[model samples]
Target: MSYVPYSVYQPLTKNEVTLLRKKQFEKWEHYFLNPIQIGQKHTEFTEVRDVILQSWNRSKEYQDLNPMIEGSVKNISDEELKEIRKKNEVFHLAEPVLKQAGQELSDENHVLLFCDSDGIIIDNYGNHSVSRNIGNSVNANNGAQWSERWAGTNAIGTSIILKQPIQIFSSEHFSYNCHEWVCSSAPILDPLTNELLGVINLSTTANSFHYLSMMKTIGLVNQIERILFHNYYQVREMMQNIYIEAISKWKNQIVILCNSKGKILKINNDTQINEITSLMSVTVENNECTTKKEWEDEVTLHGSQYRAIHKKIFWYDRFIGFISILEKKSRLSHSTTIHNHFAKYSFQSLIGNSEEFKRTIHLAQVAASSDSNVLITGDSGTGKELVANAIHQASNRFDHPFIALNCAAIPKDLLPSELFGYVAGAFTGANPKGSIGKFELANKGTLFLDELGDMPLELQVQLLRVIQEQEIIRIGDKIRTPIDVRVIAATNKNLVEEIQMGKFRKDLYYRLNVIQIELPSLRRRSEDIPLLAEYFVQKLSVKKHHGPHHITAEAMGILKNYSWPGNIRELENVVEYAVNFSANGIITPESLPMHFHNQQTLPINSVSINPVKQAELDWIIQALKRSQMNVTDAAKELKMSRSTLYRKLKKMGYDMKSLK
Candidate 1:
């Protein structure tokens, strides 16, 4: 014997079905007429479905809906509905499916309604006669708001609330105006995010209600979801290809692919997959990862710290995932070295128009085209690091890291470790998990070494060897690791003079001096002072969160005439000071720093010397006083090559030995 499949509803004769619907209709009518009588006890409407009964109660109590309303009262304007349709992806993608369903049900007295997640009908297709008949009473047309609160107990609104498929029979509708129609609706959700995109509703006349309608609606929804998933898969495949290319470009770094929710999807460096996954897991568990488009943070795993940078990936304006790159943290904690590992300035951002400054920029550009080591020479605050950053940004390795280290900033003992990383337990105070050095971190990129003249002689030998061999041995390890770093050394002290003084390695100097760029002091390039001042005024004003104050002609003259010994750095400080004190948004003479006012008087013999020469003389005198007339200490203080300082002193007829 053949077995019958189980069913939720027992088989009922046509006559019985008619009788049940009649009872349901009567209960709905009675509840509509005297809702207070039925409010006290739900048992009064025993014939009504529980879901529909609850909806009816909510429509009356919470929504205060009137069953006697003529038609949908919350219909959006045509222009508004058009805009909604334009932004909705599912509406466009499900067009073909919706059209097919509409055609199939055209002669069956049915209409297909497409509603957004908010249950506002965005589109309708099917038999015009059926649509017109139902729309006349309930306004079940395009742009009609069908949410439960607005239209009452409909399939689209109820399914939206439940996030599931639902069928509302004729009398089950809360509003009397909708009692003549039936609707089957299922939500269309994003396959990747599981977010409700919209709903597909199949509607028909009350007498034409069929149980199979619900199944058809669900099938249509499934088809739409499949299309969405297929599109998503294509985008994901494209993203994978992009990541693979990035992996090749960034071979040594750890690259990760994550979904919008911060879940790891793929990783480039499989050898460190376990460690990377552990780090990501800890980050996610601690809620450190967020939905921001781009961010960087430090994460620790296995007792080792790493800097993870996340950048969101988008396809067709839809957020797909994130491309994350991880770098092993170094021992240095200075803001310049630790946080800013990438070049932030380009050649265009370097502000200068004077012939002298322009010549320096042209040389720097030429140096950027080559792979030779660069030596930038200038006084303090001459923007040597800025030039270094611009060169790195304009170089072929711009996509890679641009690591900067100040040779004078770090202590002599710790300098070696900061240059070449050590393994765990390499030293008494070393991190247990080891740390990466600037050389390793800067592999395949440029390393800017500031204050190169201050490097200890012993370390200079190691630096020269590393440059020659293109490799480095960690402080505590004997194994030499290959590296591909383009060294760009900068200093206010002349390296040639340091070599003469037996303080610098001659070979290292030759290695680094392959390309030389000397930035001019502010006094020498006084023609560009106004431009620089204006640029700083605009830049610093924004930080102060006020008007972009302008410098008065008199104030600008004061800035131009005053000798800037501190160069561009000093100029920026002065501008920032003016911005802070410029109470009326206009920088005047009074807004200038006090030092500028003090330099108004000049000695009799100084009148013959130009402002630039006088500024240099003043700096030399200050440095001599600060160093107790010692040439070496004075050279260090002046940031001038010691040999060069002696020549200047001799030209000025100042014998240091006689002064002492």
Candidate 2:
């Protein structure tokens, strides 16, 4: 009989078919004497053996081409095994198989085998009777070595070794003692790539294996394979549908699906039909319009300024169809409340209310009133972004989009495409459907570029061009699309210094610095601590879902004295820590962080201005002065320990050398 290829739709390589056959025959020959083995007659086993051996030989010749390690033994770690189970989801998918197999194989005589990636039997059928024999042997879970070489030939290992199917009878089993049952196994192929997913086997205490039993096992394997294949295909289809929907909804683009012959299968009518109808009327009325080839973006919509960009679609490198998207020069005007544009976010959402904060907000509002580019300068964590957001809200474009992007967050190589948008498939891993960048999204609105100092020099030049020309050409495309986005840039580094260091473009800085807002650190606004602390307590309580917000006067005093290096962010953290850990209704000095509470020695908090303390200090100073500023003598006169007096003086910012 002529042998058919293993997989009908997508045939496996001859080498693969050979290997699978060889493994099947080897296991078949070794298990022939066993009652469980399927092929009983010597003649039948011999033919099966020859066929498998020939397949295996041919499979080995192409061993180098196999992506999987052939015949390699792996000591699977627990974590690795768990990962494999997660990827395979065998337990999840095996329920239906078990149900079907249970009906076919009698409950009293059946064994369902679960193996590791290497086919080492880790579990068996839930039945106690069939499981008893599998528990204590070297071939069982604890002692089993899942390799064809270790067992000299077995269904599980050889099926995996050759990536094929096999059945071993009771006596044909290589192990000397265990030949009471037959085992049938098949390689579970991955639905997507048709790789060897794993092996599924059924063992039972039955007579010599028959074609009927082997066929049942193969049927179970196919069922499981179908489930896996369907899952992958369904997930991919769902994701594609989601992408198509998102593009239509958010971007208002059109999507067309067509057959290879270019007949339209589907058309997502995301664009305005009235506009398309007008275009058709114009083409029909003007005979000149029918014969002339027009650039996609140049194709006016029914004599309207709006144009359509034509893009092709492909799936698996097959041309699906073409899509025409009507491109509007500006965003649609909406009749919603202007406040709703920033309903979820606003200047009030900013974390602080310090004098410095008020000053920053005022300047931001001033900058926003004008269309001039605004540059915000500050140290890291000084609320530069808050200022930017505030400015966006204050601008004439407040009702329009307000998009923020961190220049430093994007990789240098991809920053250009990330900022300026890109043509579809401009480079490897580029979005096939293309994407609109933040700048385009912010057209007729404000673009807040955070950490602008970190932008690459090449991208800086491109950005400058956009700012000056009021247009952008996507990467890999030359059509200059007009844009109208107000640029609001912020940086922690000084652009002058950056320019001197050759890290920032001086010309770009000049353009961006048309209006500037500088944010001051929290330490400079220590006077606002009491009010800010109260605000923080309320905000933190609400955010943390805690109740009965209160802060002791002592804690507020401690907060006011600390020089916050991390600025408002650090202050928020301290308040949050107090709110989370403090059990009392009021957060006290004791409730403050250990570092802040113990920093009583810091001069900012010490009572250095008191006259009594000063008199005592002065008397001690006089005594030390008379004793040639000897701290020991001074301590004796003050009747305190030398260390105590020294600490007091240091806390008071009194230099011992100056006292001497």
Candidate 3:
């Protein structure tokens, strides 16, 4: 008897090999049946391949497998098998490759089997009759459990135990049920984790065995792994891009990119690296962070609060890693604090009768009927916030909180905490008692985000996520608090231009702009100026403890003719100033603002000039005032190039130096 290496297939003919395997089987049976002589008798089986002999010993001794069994004892239901295949996402990736291999081997009476790491056949493809025969004889069909413990020494089961490729021929199989089959199987492993993902096996009748079968199995395994690795790297590259984009967009904040395992890959320069890592470790340990595609929560590290926004990166259906943005939670000072959480106005409070203003009010009334987000766009002081409040007051959730936050007023570093809130002791300067974020406070109600265009790009990403998920996580807290907030974001700047300039996220813009209500500027709705001025005069006179005041026809004409650059807000201020100066409780042109008095002689209402030119002159004058007579600054305020502003000023017969 001579020992043969299993690695190199012996060149013996079918008949000779059959006889040799028969002899090995007889020896195996004799050794297993006579347990008392097993140790000594195993040495006598030198003609058998050492690998096969070892498997036989494990099957009979360790597994206590009965070689006389007709087929594999363990099997799963069809539904269970389907779930296993579904859960092993890599199996789907290997299916096409395996089907191709099956096609190539169709004429060879071979069936290709894809099994999970547990050796349960998930799928099989090949000659239908051959597969039927194997299934009937050895129960090697889909869902059959082929682990060594269940199916004895066989290719699929033994390859799993060895974590390598193996060839099991007739009679070499420890179970009598598999004696007529030959199988070549190799394990497929995850490239990153190196964990056995599954096994690929080629099985056929022993009489049809070919030396190239094991080679083909190994090749298919290699090919499948290549696809897996390619997908893995592609996902890695995508996640890297996300990380880089996040770092670039959030340069001032702490950004950490991590693998699915929560290991950090890239992180911006920050002094809180260890604290962040520790926080991540806790999240992973508790199994709290990996499930969702996008989630946010607060974490406390070293007594300081941080908001950890987790955005899972995926390539198609496979999760690769995630980007974790850590924004520090800081308490806003008293001046910027938001105290009111109730709508102060209703549809009736919005006083205007011009068609343009009426149209805006109409749209807001429609917006109030639904829970959709609203974006109120207009120039400064166009009553965008007033419309937002009216919408909230008119909605069904009117009884709930109407929290408002002006994004531009709050410091960038403190905005997240203001919007999302922080836990007690979330940061060094944070209030020890912690405060509720606007999102949480406005739960089941409306959140008016004023100056939405001024929201930082990084905060915009979180805001979009919150809108989509309808949830918020307070700073320094791992638990996510669900919210039902109808957001009404108001912006004075054109978000479309801001988006093109990369200062605003287009997705966030769309999220907020689901129901856009663009209010007409005061200049466009000049017809409403007299009515607005009269309304403000009466309201201010009561506050001043005086008799109801009247804007004289002269003053009313001046108000309607002037372009109200600050819109309704400016009109209210003018009326308030007039009320203070009116000796007879009559708001006359003489009591108007000094600038308005100076521009009184300008042909602002001259019938010869078009209303467009009159409005342009008013805008220029207003910008100059706002910019404190600096032509360059006024040009920026007017959103025109300096040279363009100079040309317009010169054409309008205005001396730039005199204005300065």
lDDT of 2: 0.62
TM-score against native, each model: 0.44, 0.42, 0.49
Q: How would you order the candidates by lDDT, starting with the best?
A: 3, 1, 2
Q: lDDT value for candidate 3? A: 0.78
lDDT: worst 10-residue window of model 1: 1-10
Task: Give Cα-based local distance difference scores for all models.
Answer: 0.78, 0.62, 0.78
Clashing pairs in 3: 298-477, 304-426, 305-426
Tens digit per residue, CA lDDT, model 2, 374-491: 9998778777777777777776787788888899999999888877899997889988998877788788888889999999888888899999999999988889899998998998
| Candidate 2 Cα outliers beyond 4 Å, as residue runs | 1-345, 349-357, 600-660
How far residue 217's Cα lies from its native spot in candidate 1, in Å, is 68
Q: Which window of 10 residues has the lowest lDDT sum in candidate 2? A: 1-10
lDDT at residue 317 of model 3 (Cα atoms):
44
lDDT of 1 by residue, 20-65 (tens): 6677778888887865643456667665666776677777764456
